[model samples]
Target: MARITAGVGSSHVPLLGVAADTGKDADSYFGPIFEGYEWTRAWEREEKPDVVILVYNDHASAFDMKIIPTFAIGCGERYMPADEGWGPRAVPPVLGHPDLAWHIAQSLILDEFDMTIINEMEVDHGLTVPLTMMFGKPEAWPAKVIPLAVNVVTYPPPSGNRCWALGEAIARAVASFPEDLNVQIWGTGGMSHQLQSPRAGLINREWDNRFIDSLIGEGQEARQISHIEYLRETGTEGIEMVMWLVMRGALGARTRALHRHYHVPCSNTAIGHLVLLPDNGEQPGTDDDRALATT
Candidate 1:
């Protein structure tokens, strides 16, 4: 059976990709940021997943003001890198696991989590940047991908708790698949930084570190944290951290931290990364099980 082997949380900063592509990541200013992901690069080579269920927000690259789905799942055969103002990064196009993606979408809808099924779309920095950070400049991504996009661009996006719940459902969906495959779910974007409004470069290193601690040691408590609090404490854009909760929830209540990396001022953002594995050989709760029961 297909099993979710791990969960990863990371920040997807466009400038980080720019630095890496231009070879500035090795320079003094950006070296530390790239170095933060060094462990992850090595880890990936060791624990290669057959597929990555990437959870990220499209920064107006795929979905603009015209159409926005709170939850969109990519069921396409292939996805091209998007050109976000600057041309697209010279990365290999993403190969999607259409079969698994379609399965998850069908299961999610049946699980009562409305998901917008996308057949064709260009992936932006939100998705590609993290891939670059982990895999570096490769001929092609080593694993197949299932792009799961959540709408953080639109105000009042899905609640943190709701995202967490969705993760549980996704875990069940992945487990039901009969294919023999190792899967990893990644939640990308945010530590603490705002890239809009007058506070374009706001960051809170203290809060970012504290949040990481809470995530590693007190994940259940992290779910109760409201989005308003994230905005107030971290920054408006800091709300993106909620997506990490999705990755956490999918791994069940028990997990061991395999590795963690944190660094500040990755351009205007604070970069954070975590690699976690389920500690107990237990099946994650299902919709009927309801880790966070709906009343």
Candidate 2:
């Protein structure tokens, strides 16, 4: 049966994509940001999964004010990069795993998640930036991607607890699949950032680090964080962190933090990345340890 081998949490800052595409990632300013992912890039090459369920929020790319689904799953064969005002980034289209995606959509719907099933959608930076951060400038992404978009941009988005429950359902769904495939769940966006005025450029490093600690430690503390707390402490856009709970929930009861990188002021957003493997009594001297030693 197909099983989730790992979970990844990351911040999807659009400027990171720009820096990578324009060859500015190696420069002094952006180099550090890109450098943080070097370990992840190397670790991924060694432990690449067959499919990745990428959880991200659509930034008015596929859906507008007219329609918003609390949760949407892309079941299409391929997703083209969205042209967000400036033309689309020079990246290959994200190929989708229709069989697995459809199965997941069906399982979630049956599990009473009320997921919006989308056959076509243009993926924006929210979805693609994480891909670039992890996969680098590949001619084609190494693994098939299934876009799971959540509505974090609009008001009354799903609660952190609800997202966590959804992740559990996803795990159940994946475990039921008979295919012998390795799957990874990725939750993208947020380490506390606000894009609007009044409190624009808001970033709470202490809160972000604490949240990351809680997420990597017991996880229950992170899952119980309230929406108001995210707004008041982390800022409006910081609520995106709730999506990380979804990734955490899918990893089951215990997990080992393989690789974690945190950086501040990435285009006024805190860039956070974590690679977690389900703890099955495995030792810590994995590839992550080797990567960290060299870096």
TM-score on alpha carbons, each prediction: 0.93, 0.96
What lDDT does the true structure give each of the candidates?
0.87, 0.90
Q: Which ten residues in a row have the lowest lDDT in candidate 1?
A: 286-295
Model 1 residue runs over 4 Å out of place are 281-295
- Writing each residue's lDDT as its tens digit, candidate 2 over 188-237 gives 99989888989999989899888877766545877778889999999999
Candidate 1 overall lDDT versus native: 0.87
Winning model by lDDT: 2
Q: Candidate 2: where is the Cα deviation over 4 Å?
A: 282-295
Indicate the residue-level lDDT of 139 in model 1. Answer: 96
Put down candidate 1 lDDT per residue, 152-173, tens digits, no spaces: 8789788888988989999999
